[model samples]
Target: MFGRPTDIDCDLWRTDGALLIENAISSDELAGLREAFSRCAEQAKPDWLSGVRAGTRPAAFFDLPDPMGLDDRFLEIVDHPSFYGHLMAFSEGQVIFLSPQFRTVPAAPLSYVGWHYDVHRESTPLHMIGADLSG
Candidate 1:
Protein backbone atom coordinates (compact mmCIF):
# COMPACT_ATOMS: atom_id res chain seq x y z
CA MET A 1 0.00 0.00 0.00
CA PHE A 2 2.89 2.35 0.74
CA GLY A 3 4.95 1.41 -2.31
CA ARG A 4 3.32 3.40 -5.10
CA PRO A 5 2.94 7.13 -5.37
CA THR A 6 -0.58 8.18 -4.42
CA ASP A 7 -3.23 9.47 -6.82
CA ILE A 8 -2.83 12.90 -5.25
CA ASP A 9 0.88 12.88 -6.07
CA CYS A 10 0.14 12.02 -9.69
CA ASP A 11 -2.61 14.66 -9.92
CA LEU A 12 -0.39 17.39 -8.47
CA TRP A 13 2.32 16.62 -10.99
CA ARG A 14 -0.16 16.67 -13.88
CA THR A 15 -1.69 19.95 -12.70
CA ASP A 16 1.34 21.99 -11.68
CA GLY A 17 3.97 20.05 -13.62
CA ALA A 18 5.53 19.18 -10.27
CA LEU A 19 5.06 16.99 -7.24
CA LEU A 20 6.69 16.59 -3.84
CA ILE A 21 6.68 13.24 -2.09
CA GLU A 22 8.07 13.34 1.43
CA ASN A 23 9.94 10.38 2.94
CA ALA A 24 9.70 8.40 -0.26
CA ILE A 25 13.34 7.49 0.28
CA SER A 26 14.42 6.12 3.62
CA SER A 27 16.74 8.01 6.00
CA ASP A 28 19.62 5.57 5.68
CA GLU A 29 19.37 5.61 1.91
CA LEU A 30 19.31 9.40 2.02
CA ALA A 31 22.47 9.44 4.13
CA GLY A 32 24.31 7.10 1.79
CA LEU A 33 23.16 9.13 -1.19
CA ARG A 34 24.40 12.31 0.43
CA GLU A 35 27.77 10.72 1.11
CA ALA A 36 27.98 9.56 -2.47
CA PHE A 37 27.20 13.09 -3.64
CA SER A 38 29.86 14.48 -1.32
CA ARG A 39 32.40 12.19 -2.93
CA CYS A 40 31.28 13.31 -6.37
CA ALA A 41 31.59 16.95 -5.33
CA GLU A 42 35.10 16.37 -4.04
CA GLN A 43 36.16 14.74 -7.31
CA ALA A 44 34.33 17.13 -9.66
CA LYS A 45 36.79 18.91 -11.92
CA PRO A 46 36.82 22.71 -12.18
CA ASP A 47 35.81 22.45 -15.84
CA TRP A 48 32.68 20.56 -14.86
CA LEU A 49 31.38 23.58 -12.92
CA SER A 50 28.78 25.70 -14.73
CA GLY A 51 26.31 28.42 -13.80
CA VAL A 52 24.87 31.87 -14.65
CA ARG A 53 26.43 34.43 -12.39
CA ALA A 54 28.23 37.73 -12.82
CA GLY A 55 30.91 37.92 -10.11
CA THR A 56 33.52 35.73 -8.45
CA ARG A 57 30.92 34.83 -5.88
CA PRO A 58 28.25 33.22 -8.01
CA ALA A 59 24.63 34.20 -7.58
CA ALA A 60 23.83 30.76 -8.93
CA PHE A 61 25.68 27.67 -7.78
CA PHE A 62 28.26 25.02 -8.57
CA ASP A 63 27.03 22.27 -10.87
CA LEU A 64 28.29 18.79 -11.62
CA PRO A 65 28.24 16.86 -14.87
CA ASP A 66 25.03 15.22 -16.09
CA PRO A 67 24.12 11.74 -14.82
CA MET A 68 26.58 11.51 -11.95
CA GLY A 69 27.67 7.93 -11.43
CA LEU A 70 26.53 8.05 -7.85
CA ASP A 71 26.45 4.70 -6.13
CA ASP A 72 23.83 2.23 -7.26
CA ARG A 73 22.27 2.72 -3.82
CA PHE A 74 21.58 6.29 -4.89
CA LEU A 75 20.65 5.42 -8.46
CA GLU A 76 18.22 2.69 -7.43
CA ILE A 77 15.56 5.27 -6.71
CA VAL A 78 15.39 6.06 -10.40
CA ASP A 79 15.79 2.52 -11.72
CA HIS A 80 13.66 0.73 -9.19
CA PRO A 81 10.92 -1.44 -10.62
CA SER A 82 8.18 -0.36 -8.20
CA PHE A 83 9.00 3.32 -8.62
CA TYR A 84 9.08 2.98 -12.40
CA GLY A 85 5.79 1.12 -12.24
CA HIS A 86 4.21 4.03 -10.42
CA LEU A 87 5.61 6.46 -12.95
CA MET A 88 4.30 4.32 -15.77
CA ALA A 89 0.82 4.37 -14.28
CA PHE A 90 0.81 8.16 -14.46
CA SER A 91 2.78 8.66 -17.68
CA GLU A 92 1.66 5.70 -19.81
CA GLY A 93 5.37 4.71 -20.08
CA GLN A 94 6.12 7.95 -21.96
CA VAL A 95 8.36 9.58 -19.37
CA ILE A 96 11.90 10.35 -20.44
CA PHE A 97 14.80 11.13 -18.08
CA LEU A 98 16.70 13.67 -20.13
CA SER A 99 19.53 14.30 -17.63
CA PRO A 100 19.61 12.49 -14.35
CA GLN A 101 22.45 13.91 -12.29
CA PHE A 102 23.33 14.94 -8.75
CA ARG A 103 24.37 18.53 -9.20
CA THR A 104 24.94 20.21 -5.87
CA VAL A 105 23.47 23.71 -5.67
CA PRO A 106 24.10 25.74 -2.58
CA ALA A 107 21.06 27.30 -0.93
CA ALA A 108 21.08 30.73 -2.55
CA PRO A 109 18.20 32.95 -3.62
CA LEU A 110 19.06 32.68 -7.33
CA SER A 111 20.37 29.13 -7.25
CA TYR A 112 17.24 27.63 -8.78
CA VAL A 113 15.27 27.99 -12.02
CA GLY A 114 12.24 29.26 -10.04
CA TRP A 115 9.05 30.16 -11.97
CA HIS A 116 10.73 30.51 -15.33
CA TYR A 117 10.98 27.58 -17.71
CA ASP A 118 14.34 25.70 -17.77
CA VAL A 119 15.15 26.17 -21.47
CA HIS A 120 16.18 29.10 -23.64
CA ARG A 121 13.37 31.28 -25.04
CA GLU A 122 14.16 30.47 -28.67
CA SER A 123 14.46 26.76 -27.92
CA THR A 124 10.92 26.65 -26.49
CA PRO A 125 9.63 26.17 -30.01
CA LEU A 126 11.23 22.74 -30.09
CA HIS A 127 8.99 21.69 -27.16
CA MET A 128 11.67 19.90 -25.14
CA ILE A 129 10.13 17.90 -22.33
CA GLY A 130 12.07 17.30 -19.09
CA ALA A 131 11.87 16.82 -15.36
CA ASP A 132 13.95 19.22 -13.22
CA LEU A 133 14.43 17.32 -9.97
CA SER A 134 16.23 18.70 -6.92
CA GLY A 135 17.51 17.35 -3.62
Candidate 2:
Protein backbone atom coordinates (compact mmCIF):
# COMPACT_ATOMS: atom_id res chain seq x y z
CA MET A 1 0.00 0.00 0.00
CA PHE A 2 2.85 2.37 0.83
CA GLY A 3 6.57 2.35 1.30
CA ARG A 4 8.03 1.83 4.78
CA PRO A 5 8.48 5.02 6.70
CA THR A 6 12.04 6.36 6.94
CA ASP A 7 13.87 8.24 9.66
CA ILE A 8 13.86 11.23 7.32
CA ASP A 9 10.07 11.09 7.08
CA CYS A 10 9.79 11.31 10.85
CA ASP A 11 12.39 14.05 11.02
CA LEU A 12 10.55 16.13 8.47
CA TRP A 13 7.34 15.71 10.39
CA ARG A 14 9.01 16.73 13.62
CA THR A 15 10.68 19.77 12.11
CA ASP A 16 8.24 21.09 9.54
CA GLY A 17 5.04 19.62 11.00
CA ALA A 18 4.36 18.12 7.54
CA LEU A 19 5.55 15.21 5.44
CA LEU A 20 4.84 14.04 1.91
CA ILE A 21 4.55 10.41 0.87
CA GLU A 22 4.52 10.00 -2.88
CA ASN A 23 2.79 7.25 -4.87
CA ALA A 24 0.92 6.16 -1.76
CA ILE A 25 -1.79 4.45 -3.84
CA SER A 26 -1.72 2.38 -7.01
CA SER A 27 -2.94 3.93 -10.24
CA ASP A 28 -5.98 1.70 -10.28
CA GLU A 29 -6.91 2.78 -6.78
CA LEU A 30 -6.42 6.40 -7.73
CA ALA A 31 -8.71 6.02 -10.72
CA GLY A 32 -11.39 4.42 -8.59
CA LEU A 33 -11.11 7.19 -6.01
CA ARG A 34 -11.37 9.88 -8.66
CA GLU A 35 -14.43 8.26 -10.15
CA ALA A 36 -16.02 8.05 -6.70
CA PHE A 37 -15.25 11.71 -6.04
CA SER A 38 -16.76 12.80 -9.32
CA ARG A 39 -19.87 10.75 -8.76
CA CYS A 40 -20.36 12.23 -5.31
CA ALA A 41 -19.77 15.76 -6.60
CA GLU A 42 -22.37 15.27 -9.33
CA GLN A 43 -24.91 14.22 -6.71
CA ALA A 44 -23.87 16.81 -4.12
CA LYS A 45 -26.49 18.96 -2.39
CA PRO A 46 -27.23 22.22 -4.17
CA ASP A 47 -26.07 24.15 -1.13
CA TRP A 48 -22.71 22.45 -1.17
CA LEU A 49 -22.30 23.18 -4.87
CA SER A 50 -23.45 26.73 -4.33
CA GLY A 51 -20.91 27.29 -1.54
CA VAL A 52 -18.18 26.16 -3.88
CA ARG A 53 -19.43 28.32 -6.75
CA ALA A 54 -20.01 31.32 -4.54
CA GLY A 55 -17.73 34.33 -3.93
CA THR A 56 -16.77 37.10 -6.39
CA ARG A 57 -13.55 35.43 -7.45
CA PRO A 58 -13.22 31.85 -8.64
CA ALA A 59 -13.17 29.62 -5.56
CA ALA A 60 -9.96 27.76 -4.88
CA PHE A 61 -11.62 24.62 -3.56
CA PHE A 62 -14.59 23.26 -1.64
CA ASP A 63 -14.75 20.72 1.14
CA LEU A 64 -17.38 18.21 2.13
CA PRO A 65 -16.81 17.98 5.87
CA ASP A 66 -19.15 15.05 6.30
CA PRO A 67 -18.15 12.97 3.31
CA MET A 68 -18.10 9.54 4.98
CA GLY A 69 -21.85 9.23 4.46
CA LEU A 70 -21.48 10.00 0.78
CA ASP A 71 -19.76 6.78 -0.29
CA ASP A 72 -18.63 3.39 0.99
CA ARG A 73 -15.14 3.94 -0.37
CA PHE A 74 -14.80 6.78 2.11
CA LEU A 75 -15.36 4.40 5.00
CA GLU A 76 -13.03 1.76 3.55
CA ILE A 77 -10.10 4.15 3.78
CA VAL A 78 -10.30 4.71 7.53
CA ASP A 79 -8.26 1.63 8.36
CA HIS A 80 -6.63 1.29 4.95
CA PRO A 81 -3.13 -0.19 5.09
CA SER A 82 -1.79 2.58 2.92
CA PHE A 83 -1.03 5.43 5.31
CA TYR A 84 -2.58 4.52 8.65
CA GLY A 85 0.66 3.17 10.02
CA HIS A 86 2.52 6.28 9.06
CA LEU A 87 -0.16 8.33 10.75
CA MET A 88 0.30 6.34 13.93
CA ALA A 89 4.05 6.76 13.79
CA PHE A 90 3.75 10.51 13.43
CA SER A 91 1.25 10.84 16.21
CA GLU A 92 3.16 8.58 18.59
CA GLY A 93 0.43 5.95 18.45
CA GLN A 94 -2.14 8.42 19.75
CA VAL A 95 -4.11 8.93 16.60
CA ILE A 96 -7.80 9.65 16.44
CA PHE A 97 -9.48 8.79 13.19
CA LEU A 98 -11.97 11.45 12.28
CA SER A 99 -14.26 10.95 9.35
CA PRO A 100 -12.12 12.05 6.43
CA GLN A 101 -13.30 15.04 4.46
CA PHE A 102 -13.44 15.36 0.69
CA ARG A 103 -12.03 18.48 -0.90
CA THR A 104 -12.14 19.30 -4.60
CA VAL A 105 -10.33 22.02 -6.46
CA PRO A 106 -11.95 22.76 -9.79
CA ALA A 107 -9.73 22.90 -12.84
CA ALA A 108 -8.52 26.43 -13.32
CA PRO A 109 -5.52 28.20 -14.79
CA LEU A 110 -4.39 29.38 -11.37
CA SER A 111 -5.68 26.90 -8.85
CA TYR A 112 -4.41 27.88 -5.42
CA VAL A 113 -5.71 28.16 -1.86
CA GLY A 114 -5.00 31.77 -1.18
CA TRP A 115 -4.07 33.32 2.15
CA HIS A 116 -6.50 32.25 4.82
CA TYR A 117 -6.61 30.38 8.09
CA ASP A 118 -8.60 27.24 8.69
CA VAL A 119 -12.01 27.53 10.31
CA HIS A 120 -11.04 26.16 13.70
CA ARG A 121 -8.72 28.36 15.75
CA GLU A 122 -7.87 25.89 18.45
CA SER A 123 -4.27 25.44 19.55
CA THR A 124 -4.50 21.67 19.58
CA PRO A 125 -2.28 20.11 16.93
CA LEU A 126 -4.09 18.52 14.01
CA HIS A 127 -2.82 16.00 11.53
CA MET A 128 -4.16 15.86 7.99
CA ILE A 129 -3.80 13.31 5.23
CA GLY A 130 -4.30 14.60 1.71
CA ALA A 131 -4.20 12.79 -1.62
CA ASP A 132 -3.77 14.34 -5.03
CA LEU A 133 -5.69 12.33 -7.61
CA SER A 134 -4.77 14.59 -10.51
CA GLY A 135 -3.31 12.50 -13.27
Candidate 3:
Protein backbone atom coordinates (compact mmCIF):
# COMPACT_ATOMS: atom_id res chain seq x y z
CA MET A 1 0.00 0.00 0.00
CA PHE A 2 1.00 3.67 -0.27
CA GLY A 3 2.88 5.38 2.53
CA ARG A 4 0.90 7.58 4.91
CA PRO A 5 -0.45 10.50 2.94
CA THR A 6 1.65 13.67 3.18
CA ASP A 7 1.29 16.21 0.40
CA ILE A 8 -1.77 18.38 -0.11
CA ASP A 9 -3.17 18.62 -3.64
CA CYS A 10 -2.45 21.76 -5.66
CA ASP A 11 -6.07 22.47 -6.62
CA LEU A 12 -6.98 24.15 -3.30
CA TRP A 13 -5.63 27.57 -4.27
CA ARG A 14 -8.69 29.39 -5.61
CA THR A 15 -9.18 33.03 -4.66
CA ASP A 16 -12.79 33.67 -5.66
CA GLY A 17 -15.43 31.76 -3.71
CA ALA A 18 -15.62 30.19 -0.26
CA LEU A 19 -15.47 26.50 0.67
CA LEU A 20 -16.08 24.94 4.07
CA ILE A 21 -15.37 21.24 4.45
CA GLU A 22 -16.89 19.83 7.64
CA ASN A 23 -15.76 16.94 9.89
CA ALA A 24 -12.62 16.07 7.95
CA ILE A 25 -10.24 14.43 10.42
CA SER A 26 -10.29 10.86 11.74
CA SER A 27 -10.84 9.96 15.43
CA ASP A 28 -7.36 8.60 16.02
CA GLU A 29 -5.75 11.71 14.61
CA LEU A 30 -7.82 13.80 16.99
CA ALA A 31 -6.39 11.96 19.98
CA GLY A 32 -2.88 12.45 18.67
CA LEU A 33 -3.48 16.16 18.20
CA ARG A 34 -4.72 16.48 21.79
CA GLU A 35 -1.73 14.65 23.16
CA ALA A 36 0.58 16.82 21.11
CA PHE A 37 -1.09 19.98 22.42
CA SER A 38 -0.81 18.80 26.00
CA ARG A 39 2.86 18.04 25.49
CA CYS A 40 3.39 21.48 23.98
CA ALA A 41 1.65 23.17 26.91
CA GLU A 42 3.79 21.25 29.32
CA GLN A 43 6.96 22.17 27.50
CA ALA A 44 6.00 25.72 26.54
CA LYS A 45 8.11 28.66 27.67
CA PRO A 46 6.15 29.67 30.72
CA ASP A 47 8.27 32.76 31.26
CA TRP A 48 6.81 34.39 28.24
CA LEU A 49 3.86 36.64 28.98
CA SER A 50 0.52 35.45 27.60
CA GLY A 51 -1.01 37.45 24.78
CA VAL A 52 0.28 40.67 23.35
CA ARG A 53 1.68 42.87 26.10
CA ALA A 54 3.44 46.19 26.32
CA GLY A 55 3.18 47.82 22.90
CA THR A 56 0.49 45.42 21.64
CA ARG A 57 -2.71 43.70 22.76
CA PRO A 58 -2.13 40.63 24.91
CA ALA A 59 -2.94 37.20 23.46
CA ALA A 60 -6.03 35.25 24.52
CA PHE A 61 -6.01 31.76 25.99
CA PHE A 62 -8.81 29.19 25.99
CA ASP A 63 -9.58 25.47 26.11
CA LEU A 64 -10.97 23.39 23.27
CA PRO A 65 -14.08 21.25 23.76
CA ASP A 66 -13.00 17.61 23.98
CA PRO A 67 -16.14 15.64 24.63
CA MET A 68 -15.51 13.42 21.57
CA GLY A 69 -11.77 13.45 22.15
CA LEU A 70 -11.49 14.54 18.56
CA ASP A 71 -8.80 17.21 18.65
CA ASP A 72 -6.42 15.45 16.30
CA ARG A 73 -9.28 13.95 14.36
CA PHE A 74 -10.61 17.40 13.63
CA LEU A 75 -7.22 18.54 12.42
CA GLU A 76 -6.91 15.49 10.22
CA ILE A 77 -10.27 16.14 8.65
CA VAL A 78 -9.26 19.64 7.61
CA ASP A 79 -6.12 18.27 5.98
CA HIS A 80 -7.90 15.50 4.14
CA PRO A 81 -7.99 15.38 0.34
CA SER A 82 -11.67 16.18 0.03
CA PHE A 83 -11.30 19.31 2.12
CA TYR A 84 -8.31 20.37 0.06
CA GLY A 85 -10.25 19.68 -3.09
CA HIS A 86 -13.03 21.95 -1.88
CA LEU A 87 -10.55 24.66 -1.02
CA MET A 88 -8.94 24.30 -4.41
CA ALA A 89 -12.31 24.50 -6.07
CA PHE A 90 -12.95 27.76 -4.26
CA SER A 91 -9.56 29.24 -5.11
CA GLU A 92 -9.94 28.42 -8.81
CA GLY A 93 -6.24 27.68 -9.21
CA GLN A 94 -5.04 31.03 -7.85
CA VAL A 95 -3.23 29.75 -4.81
CA ILE A 96 -1.54 32.23 -2.56
CA PHE A 97 0.64 30.25 -0.21
CA LEU A 98 0.29 31.65 3.24
CA SER A 99 0.50 29.82 6.54
CA PRO A 100 0.17 26.06 6.58
CA GLN A 101 -3.28 26.20 8.23
CA PHE A 102 -5.59 28.21 10.45
CA ARG A 103 -6.80 26.90 13.78
CA THR A 104 -8.95 28.21 16.61
CA VAL A 105 -10.07 26.79 19.93
CA PRO A 106 -13.10 28.07 21.80
CA ALA A 107 -12.37 27.61 25.44
CA ALA A 108 -14.90 27.88 28.25
CA PRO A 109 -15.83 31.41 29.28
CA LEU A 110 -15.87 31.77 25.51
CA SER A 111 -14.98 35.16 24.14
CA TYR A 112 -16.58 36.66 21.11
CA VAL A 113 -14.56 37.47 18.04
CA GLY A 114 -15.63 40.43 15.98
CA TRP A 115 -16.65 39.93 12.38
CA HIS A 116 -13.79 41.11 10.18
CA TYR A 117 -12.14 40.41 6.87
CA ASP A 118 -8.89 38.45 6.75
CA VAL A 119 -7.22 41.29 4.91
CA HIS A 120 -7.50 45.02 5.58
CA ARG A 121 -4.89 46.26 3.14
CA GLU A 122 -5.70 48.70 0.38
CA SER A 123 -4.74 46.10 -2.20
CA THR A 124 -7.37 43.68 -0.92
CA PRO A 125 -10.27 43.89 -3.39
CA LEU A 126 -13.46 45.37 -1.98
CA HIS A 127 -15.48 42.44 -3.32
CA MET A 128 -13.39 39.85 -1.50
CA ILE A 129 -15.78 38.29 0.96
CA GLY A 130 -14.61 36.71 4.18
CA ALA A 131 -15.45 33.10 4.98
CA ASP A 132 -16.26 32.33 8.59
CA LEU A 133 -16.55 28.74 9.87
CA SER A 134 -17.65 27.44 13.25
CA GLY A 135 -18.78 24.10 14.70
Top TM-score prediction, candidate number: 2
Better of 1 and 2 by lDDT: 2
lDDT of 1 by residue, 1-135 (tens): 325668787788789865565666778877987787777767764444423333443334455555346466656777555456667667776978776645555555444434326666544322224345763
| Residue lDDT tens for model 2, 57-112 | 33566666567887787777676687777887777779886547676766765454
RMSD of 1: 6.7
Whole-model lDDT values for every prediction: 0.59, 0.67, 0.42
**Which 10 successive residues of model 1 have the least lDDT summed?**
50-59
- Candidates 1 and 2 compared by TM-score, better number: 2
Give the top-scoring candidate (lDDT).
2
The local lDDT score (0 to 100) that residue 6 gets in candidate 1 is: 80
Q: List TM-score per model, in order.
A: 0.58, 0.61, 0.42
RMSD of each: 6.7, 5.8, 9.1
lDDT of 3: 0.42
**Weakest ten-residue segment in model 2 by summed lDDT:** 122-131
Question: Model 3, which residues run further than 4 Å from truth?
Answer: 1-23, 50-59, 62-79, 100-135
Global local distance difference test of model 2: 0.67
